[model samples]
Target: WDFLESPGTDEVLYGGAKYGGKSWFLCVWSYLRACAFAKKHKIPKSSHPLKVGFLGRKVAKMFRETTLDTWFKTIPADGYVAKGNPTEIIIDDRVKILTGGFDNRELVNKFNSAEFAFFAVDQAEELTRDEMALLRLATFGRLVVNEKAIPGKGLLTANPRHCWLKDEFILNPIKQRKFVSALPTDNPYCTQKYIDNLIDSLKHRPKLLAAYRYGNWDVLEDAEQVIMDSWLESALNRHGEYWPFVKEYIAIDCARFGDDETVILLMNNTDIKEKIVMPYCRTTEISGRAAALSHQNNDCELVVESIGSDLGAGVVDELTELGHSVLVYTPQGKSSEPDKYYNCRAEAWSKTAKVLCSGVIDEDSNCFVALTKRGEGDNYGLDDTMRGQLCTPHYKWVRGKIVIEPKEDIKDKLGRSPDHADAYVIAVWAWPFISMPNKSGSVRHRKRQKSPMSM
Candidate 1:
């Protein structure tokens, strides 16, 4: 009722969990609004409706098979018809509803030229912030009623994910937006058998149950997630907090070519100064550039990961020859505690997770660690990709020892390498091992350096 009755809010999110009638709500609401406009204006029967409303998910096929199916089943069949290759529904000779997905480049391009009176995206979490912004922009100045433009109103429905939607609507909401929680229990039509199955399936995973059944956005991670969502949030909240440190370091995850990205993070203790990302670059080129950056930043120790590839080893050699102290992080090496972990990599990741969760978890009260962005200027130092990657990989027990999933598995799951998270872990892993003295007794300020590629 808030979504349909509230005209002040330009954007409204309806549901957060499955079986909440989210798709049905969006479809029925949009269709009714379009029909209302048609009835009020007495729009003449024509081929063009003068404006279009959009309804979609990430992929058109899935949208058609699922959400579109719901639309067909719920709406009145009379005077309503779906046409075209993908599908566009025309209702009562006035309202036109265009349906497509972000994955369909052609359909998305068509949306670029179209103006919408109403729009709704089901399973909107699949789309990025930019895509959502584009959808909002398409509705601007186009929602005309009685020949006067009204505030652009739209609906979004999604399950909880650590994405922009959660950050924008759930975490911090603007005045023009409203978020309505819709759980399976809220739907009277949802059968007991279905709910029982959902409960039974997710009983072993409490976090998943919290998100899927109860609509809890706070706990989004499962049991195997190395970094919990709360831990990452705590780390992000620690930004701008004061903590003194003298030692500085640079951690690099190198990628020479292809779709993989190279990430270099500069830090003073656990506080990060900058994150440099570059693509399609040589190992030597980036290493040399980082070495120069290290020199520029008071000759901080350079840490490079050299596991499963000689690229990092080559970088170490290059930096060493350039008269810079370098540390090679071979994650495949034996862990310091041989019985606790399958390898050093697993140990490092576990330690990094512990570090991020330090004050919040407090498993070790004496072990206080804070990984934050430097200064009060930047609120969030860690980017979205980095945090998501950090929380992506799961852990397993192998022969009574903890072992992290292979990089290949994570890469496949993420559809790209977990480069940013790996770089962060490498930096955290090298933190205690380096015992260099503070030259100036405090972190000296130099004009922040940016690499040519970085700039």
Candidate 2:
């Protein structure tokens, strides 16, 4: 109650394992907050009754499915008169209980014009941090509300989810905002037999059981994920710039068939600025190179600080003939850090992973849809397809060296080559140009690649 009762506390989160009595606590406490004023002052004012609201993602499911049975068992039928589609309970003729749903834009908007003395939400993790901020707006403009007459506060309860709730209340906590850990064991009402049966049913699912039984947040990892969700979320939508020992390049993953599109990633260090995805035929048309010179012109017109391609079959010869500099990725080539990585690509991607996970995830960010701008303080725009490709590849250790999941496996996982993200990794690596210090305190680079076409 430190967070709810403290003068400094305006927000508090009570979350952890399921069946930790989160729903019950919210219900019972909400009743107390509603009826406390009249109980304290026996002769209550007939004029302004106290008002409290409870909300969640869906009004129907929360009220009809989950809270319906519990609400009847807790609040006496004689004390509160309840009614309606929006759901309300009038208590002792001195308080009004309002329930709201924030599952959709229209639903959340209904609350915009309304005000409440106090508010509480269940499963707060299902909503984003921005949505919670709007909920806090309930406390504003209650100048007439007597302090003892109506004390408005915000409360949230959720299962341990890998989202903003963990970011604000668990990992980095402020004194004013409290985080109380509630395990299923903490509830006396939960019988030992019930806990045993729940644990037994989840025995085969380790990650899930850990969260449900012990509330272990660390157990959440998608086995097929190459790029972490938080890392991708932050980088994709992130703003501003940092001193990054900047470098620039374009890495192309050329398409061999009519169906696939050649992907070009424009990057500054590890940060992507743009992606150019076009079929060979389309590119030739756009470059206006007719007849035999069409392919060569199309290749040269890419214009980047530097260019590298995985397809060296003809682009290396074509671009070099056009007096354009180009490098080629040799996947099986020996690694600069042979002991730590299996091949040059593995070493490069290993470095890419470090750079990607450098920052924390920002919640409720418009990053997934933002238009990608170039140069300082910008990021390449990302769509759902790009996000799926970026997050699809997972890595594993073979003989103590990091190896990216196989091409065929990744194709199966993402339904296509991770062409955009692969080219992005190469562009960011910009191999042999700059080196970042590794854990062992060594700067590494592949042995210089031999000339494919001598100047």
Candidate 3:
């Protein structure tokens, strides 16, 4: 009711978990508003109909089956009539209410050229940021009723999901926009039996239950996350423990886009000794190569570079010419264990999880450790950012093989590339561990294996 009463607000989002009156509210509110606008400005007898409002969903078929049904159930029968090619509701003889699908380019193009007094979308989380922008563009300076102008308005309804809607409506909304949180319990008509059924169905899936039943926007996805928050928290400040070391590895993840940062890490055995990030600029490639060279030690066994840009390849070529061995780590390339993993990136991240939790390094019983700064203010450095990034990339099984989420989707959720986590995983996967000398000054060489099924 507050949303309908407030004329100053240009856009509003009514979102939450399932069984919320989102669909009912959007359909009924838009219908009533269209009718009210028509009643205020009665047109001439022979005049053409005016497009008063629009309603949409992700797909046309789904819109017809879901939101269209809700609109039909809640509207009056006498004055309004459904007509047109794709079916629009005509109210009070001359006002038209249109419907379109966000995924249908043809319908979207047609609506893009038309104007409306208001527009509403149900299940709006399925639409991309670009599609939403285009929907908003259609209403600019185009709202008119009987040749008189009025303020254009928009309303969106969605269930909890990790998308731009969460960022725009929940995290950092603009002044012109208002957010109204809705839950199943918010609707007095919602039945207790439906709530119990939802709880029973999602009990095994904790993340989904939190998102669908509780409207937790922070729960990223339903798939298994690669790194848990508890694992990262447990491994903090573990570099002080004593561990034997004979091999050194360096990993570099180059900046692929304008806003991305180039990340470099130096690891001695299972201990992460150093990490640094520099913003991308004209001298980033040159500075990155120099940074990689500066971290090299006499005991450095191998250097791995994950390249997604020409700048990254340039660093590899320059290092190869300087008598240093460098391996190109392709994220989409075939994994060494093809039967188990979908790609090298997935394999690397899975191994890193084992190292973080409890994986034996050489004869030592220590796991991977990272050093922390002693002071107070922002002492976590790239480690803190890496922890947040690490917790986002989820994995799922496809045809009996594990496949990690795509890099673009992770970037969408994080608002930046997971460069620091990428570098750390590369160091863990490509590290060449050599056994330390025994008590009798005898060296024993063995292939590194945590287990047959482990890293």
Candidate 4:
């Protein structure tokens, strides 16, 4: 209340653990306040109804399934007109409850044009920052009551999520924002059985258990998420198939040393008409030189190949002797972009992060809508093991620069080496240079045209 009632417009984030009745609070509080504004203003039924906008399908469901029962069973119906048309209610002709969602443009447009005494945002963390901004704009100058102005207020409820909510409210507390981390323990109505069910269902997903069950807002996915789980899930669920093409390179992380299996990721990046496609991935104990020979025998492009540094240097030298081009991944080698990273490995991870975070490709169509030409989206073969590996590494901040978790540390957490992940990250690093006309580094000193995968 202090934050909302203070002297300026504000948003209050009621966030943290799951099943804390946070959404319930946002709904009732906004409605009750709207009622107060209407009654105080002596507003007539024909006058512009005082309203409080509710955002998200979940909130609408809550109001319909549970909240409606509370209002009718507890509060007298004579006090207000309660009608359910996909969930809208009125109390004493004073307050109008408006609900909408990202999928409903009509609801969004209504909010855009109308004024509200306040707004209620449910599962706000699921909304992008831009969507929330639009809601705030809708509240502008609409908070007048009783011939006086009150600051436009927004109450947002959310489960634990690593999104703008975490950044604005907790990581870097924005001015005038009241961010609360509410736990199940803090709510008397939140039952132990409910909490126990969540714990049981999420026992295998540690990240979720930390956020939803424990409400550890300061932790969870914030941990070194080198590559966030969201990105991996999105990528895995986004695309299904790809066709092999020219402008290909094979990157292999050799398992010559131990229990690790060597991984070969065959990628296609030949045309600017399409984002890169990684269609073929293989795991084997085959020697590096033997793998090269196999591609050679098949009359494959076999243009560029890279080997992990952990494996013996023999295969790289042998491939060179056989007149095949092979690049060796050097973790401490100079970075392509030194400003953000210390070395090639770190830069590769940075590149992977960039592609994942930026919505360069359409989710359903798997098309590269970000490009002016509008081509197919970059794709990777779906392998659950590879997906798990892709999300395994945690990032570290070294001298203010980002770097991947050390092999030792990653192995400790994963109980196995991230060979497939290294193979993929190194493959991304190899794309710009590997496809360079036969002479890989001859044009290195000269500026080259951007790879289709970039930007």
Candidate with best lDDT:
1
lDDT tens digits, residues 109-155, model 2?
85676566667787686577788877666554431344443445778
Candidate 3 residue 274 C-alpha distance from true site, Å: 44
lDDT against the true structure, per candidate, is 0.74, 0.58, 0.68, 0.57
- For residue 55, give model 2's deviation from the true position in Å: 4.1
The residue-by-residue lDDT of candidate 3 on 1-455, one tens digit each, is 67656876888888877767888999888888887777777753334578878899887766887788888887777857887657788876678888868767777887668787788999898789998888787775676664677678899988777789988988998877888878778878877766665565344456756766666677765325676776666555453454443355567777777888877666555445556666774444644455454545553444455445566777776666665667678878898877667788877887776566553433243333443432223322335677788788876433224567778779999998988888777777776433332333222222222334432
Q: Per-residue lDDT of 1-455 in model 1, one digit per residue for the tens?
A: 56556767778887556677788888888788778767877777887764558889886766887788888889988858888867888886677888878888888887677778778898887688998878887887755666687566788988766778877887898977889998877878877766665565444456755776677777643655777767876665654443344457899888734888888888766656778888857777888789878888888888988865567778888898888888888889999877667789998997777667554222332323455533334422566778789989976433235678788779989999999899989888898877655553334323233445543
List CA RMSD, all candidates.
13.5, 16.8, 12.2, 18.6
Quality of model 4 by C-alpha lDDT = 0.57
Off by over 4 Å in 1: 143-147, 221-455
Ranking by TM-score: 1, 3, 4, 2
Misplaced by over 4 Å in model 2 are: 38-50, 55-59, 104-107, 140-143, 146-151, 221-455
Per-structure clash totals for the candidates: 0, 2, 0, 0
Best by TM-score: 1
| Model 4: ten consecutive residues of lowest lDDT | 439-448
Clash pairs for candidate 4: none
Which ranges of candidate 3 are over 4 A from the true structure? 44-47, 221-455
Task: Spell out the clash pairs found in candidate 1.
Answer: none
